[model samples]
Target: MTVDSGIQWRVGDALEPITLPPVTRLELIQYAGASGDFNPIHTIDAEAEKAGLPGVIAHGMLTMAKISRLFSPYLKYGWVRDFYTRFVGKVFVDDVIMIGASVAEKEEKGAETVYWFEVIAQNRKEEHVAVGELTFLV
Candidate 1:
């Protein structure tokens, strides 16, 4: 909570969790148009079946974007330097996403402080869909 100070970051502090509503085809379609990533597997059911998916699956980046929301409240105190993720599971239609991050480490870099966070996204079943590291420079 004390982000403006020179140094008082707790290495194991947990950010608030954000739970997003279930994924829907409409949202996926919209994301496709907006991102110009009209990948059929993310929208068309038939295409998803053709691609060996149970149904239209959510775009991996879409889930990544959800993970980024965990940093919104901290943006004013720092800028995101890097975000890395590994897609461990597929996101399907109607799957609710829960994103969370915990402070993994903190350090002072002369004038700026750096924070490393362990970020993760899980489905309603508590299965990990994404795991990653986030670097913030303050």
Candidate 2:
């Protein structure tokens, strides 16, 4: 459904995609500091190399957070009831990610509407780095 003052929110409808700033090593370090997940693989090249990684990779939660940005515009209409993410690919420094969401199904219970959404985060190569389901109430 299309709201007069908002974007479409309906089953099988996709929200506009959002591209985020490129991932950088410094940003990784900042994320580690903020999230308190100071794993060296996300901030130290030597540690990542020792772990058989191409280089320091971005944190999975960071990627998940980036994916959530796709829902920012819709929050005014309702609120997210639940969100789950599965990390599929490594996100390296300099990689740009694009995120989007599509409504999968909806249910009406009493005075509330529940929406199930499919969310995705893809890298510059268009590979899915994170994908998830989100529940929203309107």
Candidate 3:
């Protein structure tokens, strides 16, 4: 959803949540090819199992990209100045991720207003797989 840039934002405001579809092996392969991240753990189940993982897992950067989609609306409106995240857990194939964010702080920087959001990426079990902060100039 697009957050209106003209609206007054506060420190406790909640950004809308974004629910992503399940990560599939085919998609992982595609991401691997496109991103040049040909890690067997993200594609070959045998390799992942040998590495002590349950099965083929998704790339951490892929999870970060999925979570970043939540900020696209703001980016499209030129409200986002910068964004980042840290991977805290592994995401496996068939796992569904949900991205959420909340306004942590807001302040005026010169003539611009800056908004800080605490972003989180969680799996179906509500376990956080990634977390970080985003800065936006609005």
Candidate 4:
């Protein structure tokens, strides 16, 4: 989708899908350190096993960040008024995730235009990891 200054906005405009690199144990550890969320389920395989998880999982925020990156181009022109998501499934180490977004609605609100978007993230198995919405004012 083309995003230009003074461009027209339309419903159903979709951002290109962003395919993330395979999640790794090291990355989980780093995210845990950076976010101060050292939950064993996210960083330690043994602990995850004890918790009945198949393996170390990626942090929910980390997954959200990857998904939110799809909006970087839009954010340059508009401000995100609200962003939210529901964590629907686990994202484990080595999972390849893809983020996608489509404009669901657009309306003129006084001087500014408001855009509503549907954002979804899925793993290689086509399982939704997160489902969300984002609202932007441009």
How does each model score on TM-score? Answer: 0.93, 0.90, 0.88, 0.92
C-alpha lDDT score of every prediction, in listed order: 0.90, 0.88, 0.85, 0.88
Residues 1-138 of candidate 4 have per-residue lDDT tens digits of 995566466899888899998999999989899999988999888999999998888888998888778877767677888999999999988899999988999999898998998999999999999999988888
Model 4 residue runs over 4 Å out of place are 1-7
Pick by lDDT: 3 or 4, better one: 4
What would the per-residue lDDT of candidate 1 be over residues 1-138, giving only the tens digit for each residue?
675553346899988899999899999999999899998999999999999988999889999988998888777777899999999999998999999999999988998889999999999889999999999898
CA RMSD per model (angstroms): 2.8, 3.1, 3.2, 3.0
Order of models, best TM-score first? 1, 4, 2, 3
For model 3, residues 62-89, the per-residue Cα lDDT tens digits are 8877766777776644466677888888
Instruction: Give the per-residue lDDT digits (tens) of candidate 2, residues 62-114.
Output: 99987777777778888888999999998999999999888999888997788
Q: What TM-score does candidate 4 get on C-alpha atoms?
A: 0.92
Of models 1 and 3, which has the larger TM-score? 1
**Global CA lDDT computed for model 4:** 0.88
| Model 3 ranges with Cα > 4 A deviation | 1-7
| Of candidates 4 and 1, the better by lDDT | 1
List the candidate 1 regions with Cα displacement exceeding 4 Å: 1-8
